[model samples]
Target chain A: MRIVRTVADLRAALAGARAGRIGFVPTMGALHEGHLSLLRAARAENETIVLSIFVNPTQFDEAADLTAYPRTEDRDVELAASAGVDVVFAPDASEMYPAGFATTVSVSGRIAETLEGAHRGRAHFDGVATVVVKLLLAVLPDTAYFGAKDAQQVVVVRRAVADLGIAAKIAVRPTSRDDDGLARSSRNARLSPDERRRAAAIPRALGAIRDAAAAGETDAAALRARGLDVLAGAGIDPEYLAVVDPDTLEPMQVVDRRALVAVAARAGPTRLIDNVEIDPETGR
Target chain B: MRIVRTVADLRAALAGARAGRIGFVPTMGALHEGHLSLLRAARAENETIVLSIFVNPTQFDEAADLTAYPRTEDRDVELAASAGVDVVFAPDASEMYPAGFATTVSVSGRIAETLEGAHRGRAHFDGVATVVVKLLLAVLPDTAYFGAKDAQQVVVVRRAVADLGIAAKIAVRPTSRDDDGLARSSRNARLSPDERRRAAAIPRALGAIRDAAAAGETDAAALRARGLDVLAGAGIDPEYLAVVDPDTLEPMQVVDRRALVAVAARAGPTRLIDNVEIDPETGR
Candidate 1:
């Protein structure tokens, strides 16, 4: 496997492989099972797999959160190699955004401005959107893999790609989970043993809403209460417990169609989010 | 040349040409000497040339201006073919922006929000930046040609391309002009015979600034006054006449280095803008 740090080197590395399919997985450098899953998917689908490990500073609303974000470069490189990544693009902040860089890619309206946008600030998605555009352009991947854990981010990215006519296809894989049903996240590693157990409540809370919605509880208020009950039992008060349309992220009073039950809360010093999609018709 | 109205068709058209260098020139339809000059430069350097004629609605601040914007498709195709364009990607509004289009590409700071941005509103550059991104992605050209007539726009495009890590190299061709020293523009067709004569003074005013700067004039106010005097002689009251940094578009109090004297005014019912770049050392 080859590791290239500059955009020019990345392009040069992929120059001869243009005729074949290129699959990409973009992530911050803490290689967990979730990230490896994306890399594994990319490995199976394409002639070349490119993994980008850049902790995009723009996406972080708080400097402390950014500083605290994990950076396991050596471990990540080993994991990427094992996952069959042909090339790893690890660019520093200055290399990715030189001096005088000022462009922003934004997806406006509810898809981007609600839920996570509300909690993280609008700059969160704008940062995500901008960095994604840069990564997609740099990689020119035929298909890019994204986990369903960041559901709103997936929606925002899909909107930005379609609206801007980006050539790559976005493939959303199911959210990776732990044996305890906790959704896998790099931040999960930062949790202490007690915090890890508490983090499990987030997914359990979402699971309660999913189970309720599947059992024909269509009223959003009632569904939200069920999820809140689960969180309350674990002594957790969520930042938000929303029953929203899966696509638009707009709150739905009645879940007549597909809906997403998402929850966010602090587990010790780490902030984590988890979600599950529920359909009124099929319940699963 | 082959004309592809859909992005899919455009990609299909350019698929085989990817092995060779592709140059792109994006413009709004009513072709003129300015657009053709860009095409000619593209023809000389690239193995294949793609020309896009899209009068993007998002850029227009006034509905009346958008309505009055001339579109001569048949003539444009002929002019493109004569200028050696290989493929013309002419997408309709619906093709470029389908119903749910919501992404905007913006270059923040004075580079985008001042001068033309100030007069036309921020949405104008947002629109320009957005459509240009869509077009560039659609073409995936090695180099994209932009006319230097829209100087600030060139700066915006260059900034957007760099910030986004877009692979295309931006080439700015010199502003094409007429025998009367008027900058060639698609909007020039809207000028009446009397309005056309009055429009000539716009360029003359800029020329005065350029000439004065060459003769060691450094004070921006004096340079602006010299240009304004030329407009006054023609009985035209400009909407804006200021000296600004060529790259940043920030108002300059003194012209110590390269400066741009830009002016905008109404020629009868038509709004026109013209500018000339000046260097204190070698102002020609």
Candidate 2:
């Protein structure tokens, strides 16, 4: 795998591959099984697979969280090489946000205000959408890979691409999880053993909601009650437990079609989020 | 000029021309001399010139203004063809904003909160930035053109392109004006013949401010007073007359380097905007 640190170098490298199809997977380093899974899908689907690992500072509302977020650059490069990655774009903050930089991409309305967006600071989705656009343009990918772990993010990104007339197809892979049922995340490495055990409740709550939907519980308040009970029983206090339409993300009183049951909880000092998409029409 | 009404058709036409450089000039289709001047610049600068005439509704704060906005499609096509435009993208509102459209581009800060942005209501610059981005991505232009008459728009678009990491290089031309010194605009066609005579004061006021700055008058308030006096002398009640740094658009008390003297006023029923860029250091 060839590693490039600057945008110019990446573009130069990509210039030759313009005629071929490219699959891009953008990450914030500390690659886990989840990120590897995306790389695998990208590798299988396209002639060229480009992975970018830049822990964008603008996305993080908390300074300490940003500073403390794991880097693990050497390991990340090793993983990408082992995963058969073609090119890796690892841009620094200075490279990503140069001097006099003042452009931002924000996706607002009913879709952006629910679930993870509600508890997280206001500009989180804006940062994600902005950086995603920058990366997509730099890579010029035919298809962009994303994990269903960030289900809401998939919606936000899709909306941005359509709204901005950005040309790229979005492919979502199933959320990766550990044997203990906790979603795979870079922040998961920061959890203490007990905190890790408690974090599993996040997935457990989503699972219960999904199962309840599968078992004919269509009311949102009832679904929220079931999910919140699972979290509380496991001593994981949730920031929000919501049942919303998968696309618009507007909270639904009755699940008429496909919907998402998602949760965000603070397990010790770390915040964890997990969600599952459900199709009420199929009762799953 | 090949007229394409849909984004898909435009993309298909642009695919074969991908090897060549594109110069994009996005306009609201009234076919005034100012827009034609942009077409001339685009024609001269790049291998292919793509012009988009979309009067985005999201930018208008008032409904009547949108209803009354001039749209001279046939004349616009004729003017563009005569100016040597290769393609004209005249998408209707439905073509530009399809169903389930929920994406917006906003550039906020000191630059977006002054003059036209302040009085025109919020979401004006946001709309321009958003639609401009949509057009840029659709055509994938190497260089994009803008008129300096809407001086703040240049700053906003420049900031948006840079911030979003868009590849287009922004190229600005001098504002096109009529023989009477009134800036050429689609809205100008709405004015009565008498109003057109009085509208000359808008640019005349700007010219006076430019003259004062060249004469080494460093105080901003004095420059504004001189500009407003010119407008009042012609029966034009000004909405705002201010001296600002051209880039940041922030109100300045003292002219430091290059500054902008801009004004917006109601000449009878039509509102007009005009400005002049000044280098106070050299008193230009």
**Residue B165's lDDT in candidate 1:** 85
Write down the worst ten-residue block by lDDT for model 2 chain B: B275-284
- Per-residue CA lDDT of model 1 for A224-276, tens digit only, reads 99888888888888889898888888899999998888888998778998899
Q: Candidate 1 chain A: worst 10 consecutive residues by lDDT?
A: A207-216
Worst lDDT window (10 residues) for model 2 chain A? Answer: A113-122
Report the number of the highest-TM-score candidate.
1
**Interface CA RMSD of each prediction in angstroms:** 0.6, 1.2
Tens digit of per-residue lDDT, candidate 2, span A1-284: 78999888998888888788999999999999999999999999888889999999988878888988999999999999999999999999999888777777888776676776777766888898889998998888999999998998999999999888889999999999999999999999899998888788888888888899899988889988988898888797788887877877888899878988877888888877888888978877
Using lDDT as the measure, the top candidate is 1
Question: How is the predicted docking of candidate 1 categorized under the CAPRI scheme?
Answer: high
State the lDDT at B196 in candidate 2: 88
Off by over 4 Å in 1: none
TM-score of chain A of each: 0.98, 0.97
